[model samples]
Target: MRSGPYKIIIGLALWLITPVETFAQSILRDAETEAFLHESSDPIFRAAGLTPQSVHMYLLHENSINAFVTGGQNIFIHSGLILAADDVTEFLGVMAHETCHIACGHRLRRGEAYANAGTASILSMVLGAAAILAGGTDAGMGIMMAGQSVAQGQFLAYTRGQESEADLAGAKYLETVGINGEGMIRFFDKLRDQEILAQVRQDPYVRSHPLNRVRILQLQQAVETSPSYQKPPNPALEEKFQRLKAKLMGYLYEPRRTLRKYPPSDTSIAARYARVYAYHKSLEWDLALTEAKALVESEPQNPYFYEIMGQILFENGRVRESLPVFKQAVDLGPREPLIATAYGQAMVSLEDPDLMEKAIPILEDATRQDSGNTFAWFNLAKAYAWSGRDAEASLATAERFYSAGVPMMAVMHAQRAMESFKMGTSEWLRAQDILYVSQEAAEKLEKQRRRQERQRRLSFED
Candidate 1:
């Protein structure tokens, strides 16, 4: 039941501190992590009266602990925050806070305020320049100061107010969802001293989120007053969180570091998950397969375990062996677009015309379920190409590029697709949509390029 690919940020200036380029490039996508996050945040979203399916959550590749809401219903969580959380509750608390931000319309209101402030600031600057030219230095200085005050007030004061509101609302949401709100208090307490740290050393959360002793006290009081304040942690949720952390650590950390972190002595499921990835990363395919098989045996019904096994085998050119494992994973997690995509990918790898026919339908379904998955679109294109569905293949290629953030390429392929399909056909209409969006993306990229060029020229002039 995947909704769609996240709306790529592109040149959106959502965060004041984070540059548009940095924000766009820092996004990381993984099926397992996304699924886990959705599972964890679903309750908080529900409590906030938001449809969990409509809210897209993304993981930022940054190592600094941070989370923020932007672009309406999107929440971006840094990988460092996930790794740093002591338990599932802490992570859930963060999710609750971010969800509350979205539910409260904080970002939208803040964005409007900022936009208005920016307009005022520009007008003031114009007046200030006119005053200076007229030899009224005092008036110019006063006008400039007023402009700065407006910008600063909008940026800092408005955001701080929003932060406080999100904290209160988030705690209430967690309580309403039957989750302990104390986790929010504890997480803030852990970072309370961070306010005193040097800006360079401070976590992104500390910089972006205004926190204080009073705010912490307020959260504590809220938790104390809530009836669900002392709710026990769910074991299933804890296990899933641990496995997610292990998976992230294994994939992101150095192989040596991952192996050392989860040694042979640690025989837990999380340990096994980490080691499997570590072995795979180190190119020890045999060892990785052995660990993956052990995991499948331990959790026979766990689709993720089977996914790891299939991945190891498929990546090592054991397509025949990988096929059944992928199928099993899909059968267990039919609704998971990633698993279904993987199964389709395995079928495509067989390169048989008959297999391509089967792969096409599976991949089409997978892409339909999760339109943001570039890999699924890629494999779908391959299947289509093999089956001589040239127009569909071209359209799929366009979609894959679009999801991967290559707008010019997407536009080119989409145009090619347009030529292959009959006018007013569904395929032709899809290509038209892709072309329209991709052209807009191309324009955005060009504007960004011009801005960068202007900045560079100004820097050189200075």
Candidate 2:
């Protein structure tokens, strides 16, 4: 309470901000995976005195072994990192560490360092030029090299300090949550081998996280000395972790590879869940349907199984069948926005007047539940359009584009929506707000583009 916590922005830009080094990974959405991540990380967030909802976590379809927090409370995790984790504990360890970075204000501190680093680099070039004028070319080059070395040293030293701080803080959070730091240390051990590899070959996690031998040893010693380290593992949690990994493996790997790993002989729940996707992806519709049916039969109450069945059936041209399956999923997990969005989308695809009318309320509820979901917003726009609410559709489209960071498109739609609504009305005001915000964002992007263009021209001249 003593700390002044800035308001967390809930929108597309924050959720899908630039990756670590402008991470190019695409954002992946899944209802089940998101639920799993929140369930695992919520306790750690609470223990760290942070609200789980205030901190948004996004899954990236990235193969690099990385997880990083950016734009304050946003954490982007790579799929490779999850698959690389041997178990849930290891994955949670990374989550705790990233959360600790937010708790400790590392992002703000790092931002300060970056600003200073740029100034130092520019100052060094000037000093280097002065040396060249006073002495010779060699002397100037040497001055520049030394200056850069000092600048780089300062940044790396500060980063290492923060990394060490987060490591200890993460360990404390784990202990507070009654989870042992053994998994934390084990994950570190897994990455320790990367130290021997050449820098270019190192995983993004190792590169960005910067794990020195001393820090690793200190972390290991601290975790081992803590009483929580002796705590027994949770079998139920481990089972969930296994299934989470299995699902990722099925989705990430080739169908051939997944089938090989979870062959016909394998009848475990994990294998069954994985083969459902593998068979679906590999175009073996019958096998996929069979596996999905088996899963639903085994866990009649599980909403996710119904979701998968609905998706498989819908994608395979069994639209009517999928409608009921998707509806079942919604009935079971009514609060799940993504599932509801899917059901709404399926209803829209049918183009039936009755179905479209029904979809309007469902899509509206989905968007109301999670306004940041672009998919839901898009579906809602379609439903609104079908219901002869063209202005509402335009407003919804504006909202969708705004949340997707497409400011120009948002501005265009917002303006159109504004034209249709009377002044002083809520819809008109909202349209005006969207138009203003999106126009500003669009202008900012244009300015950046111009600046980058100027830089390129200068580089060409040099």
Candidate 3:
């Protein structure tokens, strides 16, 4: 009920948007994200004493070189760390660390502490972020809580004595997995070096995790004592992992630098990775297509490889071509919300309004799958808008935009719906009521707009 400027904007953004029914069906399904979760058949899962429910690894798009555990069921790894690793062993090392956290029940303790402290507000934020990381629906609810309640002190509690516990646990897991703890040491060393150069002083991981010289020293000692701490010869899987890492780096790095680091070679898949980025960065659509085509040909079964091709084609505005590639990806592996969302977007962009009948249910599935997928909501909003169901469309668009962190777009959609209600039929008035807007404000805005338009034309002529 507050009349402050910010409150007004929030109110409009939350409730009053025009019904753009066409934008409702564009979210990525849970099946998609579920497919992308990390799984391994290594005996270490059991050897490390990890219950199946205790260790669920997720791949997040965050570029920061960090990995964290939110609770017993969720271990979040940043994509940047995966891309930065020299081999699968190093990647596994990070997993081992997070796994240690779960095995030690640190995350579970944090949750218990927060609840017992009556810090429901801070716990709400953590739960929200955790939900998105776990690929769950209602992720936006988490974001809303995060915005209202996140505090450095509360987050610091997640780090207390937990880092050392994970380091030791990871070292032990490496032993059971027949992996050298040295790999873990190597990855931690890299992170330590990064911390010194970071202008921000606190890397996202370091801020949340209490990494220190003592922690590093302790890990080194663990590796030194661990039996046969030797680097394993890179396996076939390592090569596949490299290709995946390179492809990701290609997207993140400048083309020239990527090419220099990953020179063209017949045997090296990194070259293809570099080329994909090069062509894309250079805006050479045809060349990018050629590179992507070659990549898909060589790695036919890798869904991630297809994702690269689909991304290239999509960025180049070849929506039709992009659609099939994304579809191929979905067929290859349907659990990634990103792929499904992209596929749904392509379907909507193809100009078949009837196709939305197909897309809406898919997006609903996606939202139910993981409510944090803002892009899916965005595509759904467009679908709804074009379908002439303005009320639902506006709400969907507003919510999608809000989830995407685009407050302006959210406010615009809300305002559009409010205006439509004022100008259109009694149906518009009915819809406005549903949107939670007052008749007095709606009439005032309409009157203000009419006066402004009159002034705009007169000023233009003058």
Candidate 4:
């Protein structure tokens, strides 16, 4: 199943009942959507005096309206928030706020407090060690609750202060970039009503950010006072935003809902995009093909239209037919890592020796451009294995596993890679690095197991 451009691998039974933490296990990794997010956030990041490329954006598979900055330069945004946003500016406003948290070193300061309270080490252990060992057991729940209690109690006030600071800082960034700060105010205003709801019913953003009427008023005042308050929205940007939202709706929502929202009466490109996804999801391949071909005809130069068509054809068991479409997308968007990755993936899927050889360099280049791309690494591994490059294939598998946070598997593949490579070579050294990290992860897991066991024994005695 898919949700708003993200593939959901968990079974429907598990997916329906899974908690938020379990949902975090899935990640959405579309190249085009990620690229668009980066572009939208670049101005805000730059205005905050941070390099645009320094912070990485991750779209979580969950459907909660929230975005958060963690211990590192990673920003996680839920696809629900994206779909919920009214416009590009509204979404960008959220990005600006998260970037403010990172730029202001709020996470670092909080970490320092955690360290002072002797919770930092255990917190890290909870994420890596306890998570690996306990899975969803009571021990795991206790550990997580302990960490959250400490974090919430010790830093709640500080975090609220930071939220206000981020709001002001984000408005300043939008102003500096000539974007209307009203969008930020408007988004917050929309959430203001959520403050009155029960805690469990409130959106995650409301719960995390601590929204209030006073804050909304202050934000509105600040935005109205900004010189760029009346600036018009960029037409091109708005178009991209519309297309992205449509694409996501088509992929994520139920086919019936999608078709209802974008009926046959709606002939706009965005409407067509949604219908194509709906048709594809409904297994109406003929209708999907017709809509996709129409999209291609309407926007011959748009790489995304071709990309979507290629994806539909490829997924529907038309490998040979999909190749030319994917190539066209790559040719149109040469610098696009996602398009290149898709082309390479298609080639690797062909299982032809010559095609696999051709795919390797493309996959390699795509991975080089975006090292965080799991799809590229996985396909690159397939390409390598097909060409009988066992050592390289093992290394690529290790990379894929490492990126997916499966350090044990990563270590296994790294060990295999080491056996295939000569001593003192670059590949051997890289394998050694993977082995070292994975071993550290293993040790952490063991520590967490011992800690949980001791706790369980103590409880039993009591």
List model 4 lDDT by residue over 1-462, tens digit each.
223433321111011111124222344556567678887888889999998876767565456687776534557677788888888788888888888888998843345545544443356434633432422122222233334333232332236678888998999999899898777777888888898898778776776677777777777788889898877677778777887788778777899999999998998888998898888778898898888889999989988788878887787888789899989988998887878887887788889999999999889998787664556788899889888899999999887766555568879999999999999999999888878876775576567667878878988999
C-alpha lDDT of candidate 1 relative to the true structure:
0.72
Task: Report the Cα lDDT for candidate 3.
Answer: 0.58
User: Which tens-of-lDDT digit does each residue in 142-215 have in candidate 3?
Assistant: 23233222322234345647778888887888777677777777777777765565536555565566567899
**What ranking of all candidate models by lDDT puts the best one first?**
2, 1, 4, 3
Error of 1 at 49 (Å): 1.5
Stretches off by above 4 angstroms in model 2 are 1-23, 108-158
Clashes of each: 1, 1, 42, 1
Question: Which has the higher lDDT value, candidate number 1 or candidate number 4?
Answer: 1
Give the 10-residue window scoring lowest on summed lDDT in candidate 2: 1-10
Per-model TM against the reference:
0.83, 0.84, 0.64, 0.85
CA lDDT, candidate 2, residue 355: 95
Which window of ten consecutive residues has the lowest lDDT sum in model 3?
Answer: 8-17
**What lDDT score is found at residue 11 in candidate 4?**
15
Model 2 local distance difference test score: 0.73
Best-to-worst TM-score order: 4, 2, 1, 3
Tens-digit lDDT track for model 2 on 1-462?
011111111110112222122223345567777888888899999999999987777676677687876435667688888889887778888888888888998843345445655543444445544433432222233333333422122332237888898888998898888888888788988898998999668776776687888887878787887878878656777777788777877776788999898997998878988888777767788898888888899899988889888877777878788999999999999988888887887899898889989998998898878766776788788888888999999999998776655668889999999999888899999899878866765675566567668878988999
